[model samples]
Target: MSIVLSDQDKSTLRAAAYGAVSLMAAATGSPQKAATNAAIALRSATGLVGHVLAANAKDIELKGKTVAELADRVLPALTAAMKLLGEQAPAEAGNFHGTILLAIEAAQIHPDKANAIAAEMARKITAALDAGVAPAAAAAGPDRPELQKAIEEIVDSGFVGVSLRVHDERGEWVGSAGTAELGGAAKPPTNGHHRIGSNTKTFTATLVLQLVAEGRFGLDDPVVKHLPEFGLDERITVRMLLQHTSGVFNFTGEVYEDGTIAPGIPIPYGTTGQEWLDNRFKTYRPQELVELALAKPARFEPGTGWSYSNTNYVLARLLIEKVTGCSYAEEMQRLILGPLGLSGTVVPDASPELPEPHAHAYYRHGDTTVDVTRQNPSWTSTGGDMISTTQDLHTFISALLGGKLLPAPLLTEMCTPHPTGIPNMDYGLGVFVVTTDGGGTVISHNGAAVGHAALMYSTPDGRKTLTAALNCVDDANLTIGAAFQNAQQRLVNEVFGGGQADPA
Candidate 1:
């Protein structure tokens, strides 16, 4: 049933809007004097949302006006601003709507009909006011078209969506491209969380080092020394596991240099891709995953060669548990996520959910595009099953390299790289040390899960960083490997080529 509002309801709604505007403006800086702040804010809001004002305004003459009159006059522009932001990022549109609706509840306008108009007006006013933000924030914002083009190129290369965040001396710039879901237009949230994949290895390795620093074990100690129940090889030292020198088989399956495959778990992107899709939500313990790999032959003798083995990380997970009598998730929070204030991160165990406001990941299951955003990541365990946002990744990597997480010597030791047979490419404990044509070495770790991926990179000094998340249609064949690699190189060159971050 439609309802109408009376004059008294309008007056109360106006009063509430005035109060909220004054309160919100103070949050930006002016706490002690809201009225003085409100006067300053109303002027700023009109200037910032001037395009909206210009579009919505009629023949009403322009002149200096009181705060109440300006608020009433700009209500239409506010609604338009919210609509624009909603259209720009659909994932956050619902939250914006909820915020606007909540603003009216404090008014306590009686009768459902009166409440409806109040809510609508409140939403419009709140949105328009929010668009005003602060002049300093707007000035500090990163809108470099060149970086924007880089992300656009990534999405244009057949990915569904890509959300990127770059923290550099140029300041923090975030951008996204493509649809939040297939067959839609809204961009992914730049701060949205996605599967961090093997980036979890970096976090797990950090935990191991932290334990070592606590005198729990030495990096050179044998794996079996702590995890004796697993019967790991005597030569497979803790360093081997962190450095991919353990020679253990990758439980997700491993590819030999000659291209033959040794199968382990039926995880995504493996030869058993269809089987993995069928059992995506099935849970497996870390030990169970490690056992599957143990049943297979080792890739090489301990410390002889390097291979990306998920099993090494699963063993690390159990090692963490066995050594500390705590789950990997709890320890990670205690040592890293919680300490760094990364509230968006989740150490999900046997969980198939991505936190809200995330781009949905898709996979090609024969002819249909399947939504694989939610799946029991226990299959990958500590090797690849963590979820985080670009912001959190940036915070974690910056902290780690800036000497906030580990000691100077340990970080130096952690960064020491061993050639992985790929020319100029080396693997560190859980990170990659790549010598770039830019005449600099970049420390990085990137990972991909079923239909999602994360990109994390930082300078050795941690002064600059790039962290990103993407959703796309993936399959066992790794259909987008070329595009993914190209995207990586393009971004690297743009970021670190001694001021050669060209848009082209």
Candidate 2:
């Protein structure tokens, strides 16, 4: 999932980063204070990007100019500007271009200079990104145009960015499209981390099943037996919770059969946009969240019908915590992440941070868009707040299917689907049994939290897999839902030959 950069690439990126900082400062009329501030910001961005590229995507090149070498070679004024500005730059930040863009967007750069800066950026991209990937390249499997066109179509449909990685019999292939940050030319970092949303269910589900495999508890065990404090109906078994047949009220809100949504906890927010945004930083205990859902009327009798509920997994988190006597984050590391070597994933129990090298996500506010990249994710809790990259996702799902993470029977139980929640789609314990266009099944799950989302899928044997991350302009009205759905299908069909099967 990551590209290993050589020494030369590091120097290229560092020098390019410094020049980018100087360029923005120069545009602002070389004010002494502005120069110093830009320096601090620029170094932070560059350093972050440097470590990211080295760790994740080695294929990302600065494009066209080799970036800022010209600025460094000919411009003594660049050095003079920095000297005039004192050195106080942070060691690192999220991404190279985005850090600079954030600086320029907030600074007093002249319109002309800003355009020049934009032009410079417009030409900047990770190398080989703009051209067609030849089928014969043979590095990560044969380059499939069907796959390439799927992502291109997704970007054309208006999602801001996508990073996809696949593993098939031929080999592996990775590609990305759209922009890493809005108004910038670079593609999303192919291995950049982003929120994995409800796909966290699969991970949590896997953890619980692992516990079952360890004989810690039975799948059919009553929830009341483990954490009797919630007073959950005795009929609601552990299996029902993972399968989403528990009929519990969704804490974040839910949509019903009549096309009416009963709002719960102002969540995933069924209310005004700004109010949800305002509460993003607030933290709630898992019990608080579960109790809030419990206080809401049950959607249906437990195990009687099906509806997707975020509350199920929060309770699952508590279940894991209760049984293990440690935090879910700690158990996740010990059980799956460390064993599978998924370096790009994080449990992020209430932390709002996305590790370095991530696309900026945007939330639409009326006619304008607001950056929604960082917010306390306790609202997402165990259901949807986990962060990960395409590579780590690929590794996790592949290992899970390959029987590296659980006993064969449990993994089988994990993938077996029951009809529920949505039409034509069937729910497995934590994964989805999506019957594809080819009448073949692909084990899969996908999740979205506000402006960022992830897609994951694999064949029954795990020999083939597709894992992807997308950043986009999102809204309370689900502005991009239709197009986003279309994009997911296109990619799914191209990669997995999806037919009747759809991503969950």
Distance from true location, Cα of 33 in model 1, Å: 29
lDDT (Cα, tens digit) per residue for candidate 1, span 70-111:
555455443443444333322222222223333222232231
- TM-score quality measure for candidate 2: 0.73
| Model 1 TM-score relative to the real fold | 0.74
Reference-based TM-score of each model: 0.74, 0.73
Instruction: Write model 2 residue lDDT over 1-504, tens digit each, in one string.
Output: 243344554454454444444444544555454555544444332123435333433432333353365444423322322222111111111123334443333233343244555444323322111221222123223245666667878888888988777767644556778999989998887667899998999999999999999888999999899999989999999999999999899988877779997776654334657787778778877899999899988998988887888899999999989988999999998898756545557888887887656898888867777888987788879988899877678767877898999998998898888986565578898888887767788888899888898988888888788888989998877878888788778777777776433444
Off by over 4 Å in 1: 1-143, 498-504
Computed on alpha carbons, the lDDT of every model, listed in order, comes to 0.70, 0.70
| lDDT of candidate 1 at residue 372, scale 0 to 100 | 92
lDDT of 1: 0.70
